[model samples]
Target: MIKAYSISLGALLLGLVLSLVFGSDLAFQRQWQLISGVEPEQFIDFAYLYSLLPRMTMALMVGASLGLVGSLMQQLTQNPLLSPLTMGTSSGAWLALVMLNLWVPLDIADLSAAAAMIGAMFAMFLVIAIVGIRNLSGLPVVLAGMAVNIVLGAVATAIILLNEQFASNLFIWGAGDLEQNDWFWPLWLAPRLLPAILIFLLAPRVLSLLKLGQQGAAARGLNVVPMFLLLSVVGVWLVAASITAVGVISFVGLISPNIARRVGARTTSNELWLSCIIGALLLVFTDLLANALSEQIGDVVHSGIAAALVGAPILIVLCQRQLRAQDQLSLSLPQSRLRWRNRYYGLAAFIIALIALLSLLGQHNAGSWSLAIPDAFNWLLRWPRWLTAVSAGAALAVAGCVLQRLSF
Candidate 1:
């Protein structure tokens, strides 16, 4: 535990320091002075004080909060396949913003944050309502979250398509950029996140009890229902505030706790704290990558995009064998006894290679599709997106296989 934390803390500090060093033209001495509250004499000084500092702070706060809540929920339900993202928070917040922009255009700017938080809370409760209090342990809660996400996402998309003009300003937020021109967002978000202290204070004991099984915990005189709801609402508040601060940065919350467990976070509190550190480390590096890649490629890659690009592959690598669980299913299907064949494997490989070849070389221009090698610039731009797509698709395919196999 000590070694794991020492390494994680060192890496996080290195990432933060590197981000500050490489992101600006100012010297480290001047940066230290700025941190010491010296008055700014140059634009870079002001940028360092305002833009860089607040952005990093936001990233850490949001990342830590997400990781904390994610671990909280996963431990609560004893289900590793859960996170705030999977609980419909993002979609709910998205739909609320869309509706606010449409129906309350005059107050949208002022009320957007509140609407998002409320929407997120509502979505969580809706999922709990679907699964019922007794059914929050496993796949039902996850499915409920998915159902809410699909419905809310579809509605939000439909509204945006119909009212594109009202939502014009939301395009950038939707992409999850963490660039801040001032400390206003950090200030706005900080107090709202104070409730996280409550989680830190209350959750470890409850979660430890929870690990003993619900019946056993009840035997120990823990009132599981009220404690569960209180903790859950607190978790939702933290997640919603993070989402409101940064638009829908997925994977940090989902992946951080999983990584923490892999790296020797044996205790509930240890997992929570380590995941928080890891989450912050991930977002800082991801944000740095987004900024650096944008400079290199002359395309603004948002933090969310960079996160997905990084997270999908890490998730598959870590959880490919771990995400599956044994569950009894009532439904049955006729089993097909098929023998594995080399020709089948060869044919599948051939099809995959053809698709990859086309994906790398195919271009649609002017009215028709043409097959040609991409130039260097296009290759740099396309490869990450393409590889991310492949990773995401493979992850989904694996999940589908798990679901199918788990059912019968």
Candidate 2:
């Protein structure tokens, strides 16, 4: 435990120093006199120093809060699948932004964070309702999240189609850019998050108790319902704030905890601290990559892709043959009741309908709609959007059903 704490503390301090050094260097480089012989303290002018200080503080607090939330979420859901993005909160936040844009026409630059928070909370509410207190699990929440995400994504797409002027801006934001001017974001997040962090710290044993099955927790005299709800609210708030500030960076919550566990943090407290360190390092490193690579690759490569880069290989390893074998032996699986009656015929009909739509609406932006239909159809099966959506939905549904059966 001491070793873990020391490692985490070391990483945290190191990240802070690097953040300050890099941030100051960038500010200095922007000016020629500072490049030559200006004092380092001159680079840290009142305005520059203030801006740098607040943003750095924001990053640390936000990262730590996000890490804590991820830890609690993984433990509560008992699945590594749950995360702010995967669980649909980020989509919900985007949906809110779309609605705000359509309805209010207020300055998005001013209201982005507020809109994000409301949207994230709304998404969390939907997930909680679908999973219910009795049926709560990582998988059901993920399915509900994906459904919300798809519907919201479709809506956002429609908005973009109608308002082409905003398309580029929305696209940029959607891809998870953490660059912001607000020195107040950390201040906004810190006060709200600090109470929960304190509660978590004081009740370390409670987290371990909660990690046990509901029955085990109850047997230990824990108030499972209220405590669970409280933790979820804190987790959601932490995620919402981070997403609001950083945009929808996928897999930070999902991958950080797993990495923490892999590094020898087994118990809840250890995992929580390690996750904070890992999450901070991840965001800093990814932000570095974003700054360094943006000139080469253009702005299309986002910080969120860092999670995929880091997490994808780890996910495969986590699902290796040995793990599968252990799961097969130790777990008695539930039979799946898939509703497959006229689905395939319906699917074929839909494909034909899509073809017809393409025939009618072809040639909007580019090539002949008629020619594009076949290409699109052929490509549809291989399309990342379609394939990921369907696979994620089906897998989450089955997993949810299985978990509900086993837990019940």
Candidate 3:
């Protein structure tokens, strides 16, 4: 516990320093100089440092909250593959927001978050229902997540088709930008977080027993079903609150717990605390990078999309390696199962042709179902979306099939 606490403090301190050095203050030096009417601090300065507090506080709190939730979730589900993102809470929240704005004709601008929270809970319920029915394991969890993600994604696409403005904002938000427009952080997160932390801290004995297995925990007089439900609700809350604040930051939950495991933080208690620290550090650093580079690139670049671009690939590699390791333990599984195979090639081709035809067929106007294909780069910019979708869908399907075969 001491060691974990020390590590947490150390990481937080380091992240704080790094965040100060590289975040918005550094990125927008000209603006700061214009505002402060003085030379900017190289590493730390009192003038602009006060401004960093809110952003830093939001990042740390959200990161720690996500980390703890991730650890608790992994412990309860007994599946490292499971996280709030994969479980469909974030996507569900986005979908809920889309629905509220689309069908209800209500201005959810002030209250969009409430809609997201409710949606996240429902999404959590759906995931839990799917996984619970299958008796729970790595494969079931991953498959269920994939299914939920697909469904939610389609719903989001449908919503976007209806309202392009909402779609545009939703897309950026869906990619998970942590920038705050107001003091919404403390208002939304603080109330639930304190009590959740207390509950988790007090329930360590039960959590430890849970690591043995559900039946093992139950044998020890812990009510597995009720506890699972409670943890699921808390997990959903943490995820919803964070997403509400930051707009769907991906991989914090997965990466934090994995790093904790790698660092030999084997106990659930240690894992939980360590995961929080690591998660905080990871996000603060990522945000720093976002601020630094995106500022340089200007209007053409997007920080949220950039983080997803980098983080998604890293996650893919890590997950693949882990899957490979799992496959190795059961040597009888065919090596063919590990190979990359595309399943949606044919479907993707058809979709691409259809879109191309529509693009060609549609009249060039202000707005219509016909997408205005640029005359200059018609082949270049237009074809990639369909091709990319097909390629990704095919690859995922093949991977799933392989994993299922190996697991069987």
Candidate 4:
């Protein structure tokens, strides 16, 4: 626990230094003076003060909230791989916002947060329904979450694509930009997040009991159902708060708690606090790195994209390690009978081929459909879409295979 705290503090200091030094175009001393109200001249431009300081603050707060939520979620479901992203919370929120913008056509500033929270809660309930409260386990819950995430993602993407012009603003937000023009967002989010954090903090023993399986926890006089429900509400609310404040930033929850565990956060109490610290540090550093690259590239790189790039590999490594550990345990068990492998493979291949063929040959002009061989130049346009469909199908197939193996 001490080592984890030390490492987290070191990373926090490093991130703070980097953010102060390079987060803004101004000199370090000048930025400090502006921030501290030490210089009247430096305070003249409200843009620099509001944009830089608030953005950095928001990043830290959002990261910490996500980390807390992630820790709570992992404890609730006992699933390390499950986070807001994987569990459909982020996607559900995004989808709700998309639908609201599409159908309601109102000024969505105030409504977005409510919509996001509702969507997140709905997704949570759906997952609970799919994997019943009694069946709360890592693999089953994660599998249900994956299904919900896929459905929400597909719906959001389809809505955005169909209403491209209307969703132009949403596209940027969906990519998770942390660029803040004022302190309003940070001020808005802080009050909402504090309660969730407090709820989690007040229930450390409950969370610890969850580390014991449901049966064990029940044996110890823990009311598992109500506890899970409470944790789920708090976790989903934290995620919604972050999503509404910024956008859908994936994998912070997964990365933070796992890193905390690696560094020696053994108990739920230690993991919760250390995960928040590490998560804040991770986002601050990632945002700093994005800003640095943006200066050279002459284009802003979203921190969320950078995080996904970095976090995806980390997730792969974690999954690999988990699989290896599971394999060792499974080796001693009787081998399960493999069923319909060839039939499933053939069906998957056929679906991919059919989708690709339709994408390539099928065309609609002025609401009339036609199947024709396109010219060479036209084929180039169609081939990319066909290839994308094929690739997506292949990826989904691979994911299903992995999920099936993991479940077993």
Q: What lDDT tens digits, residue by residue, belong to model 2 across residues 51-154?
A: 65565665566556666677777777776766676567778888778766766776866776678778888887787787775544434555577788788778
Candidates ranked by lDDT:
1, 4, 3, 2
Candidate 3 local lDDT, 1-408, one digit each (tens): 676667767877887777766554454565456356665555444334444655777777777787777777777777776677777887898788777766665576567667887888887778878867434445456657768977997888777877896456767766676665445565667775764675456556767887777778888899877877777776777777777766777777777888788877877777877888888877777777777777787753333455566668866766666564443454344556564448677877788788657755455566655555457566666568657876897799999889878756
Worst 10 residues of 1 by lDDT: 322-331
Q: Flag regions of model 1 displaced more than 4 Å.
A: 106-110, 129-140, 316-319, 323-408
Tell me which of candidates 2 and 4 scores higher on lDDT: 4
TM-scores for all candidates? 0.78, 0.69, 0.72, 0.81
- Model 4 misplaced stretches (Cα beyond 4 Å): 38-47, 105-107, 131-136, 324-408
**Top lDDT: which candidate number?**
1
Error of 4 at 84 (Å): 1.5
Q: What pairs collide in candidate 2?
A: 362-369
Stretches of candidate 3 above 4 Å error?
A: 1-8, 24-51, 103-114, 131-134, 300-306, 324-408
User: Could you give me the TM-score of model 2 versus the true structure?
Assistant: 0.69
Model 3 lDDT, full chain set: 0.70
Of the two candidates 2 and 4, the one with more favorable TM-score, higher being better, is 4
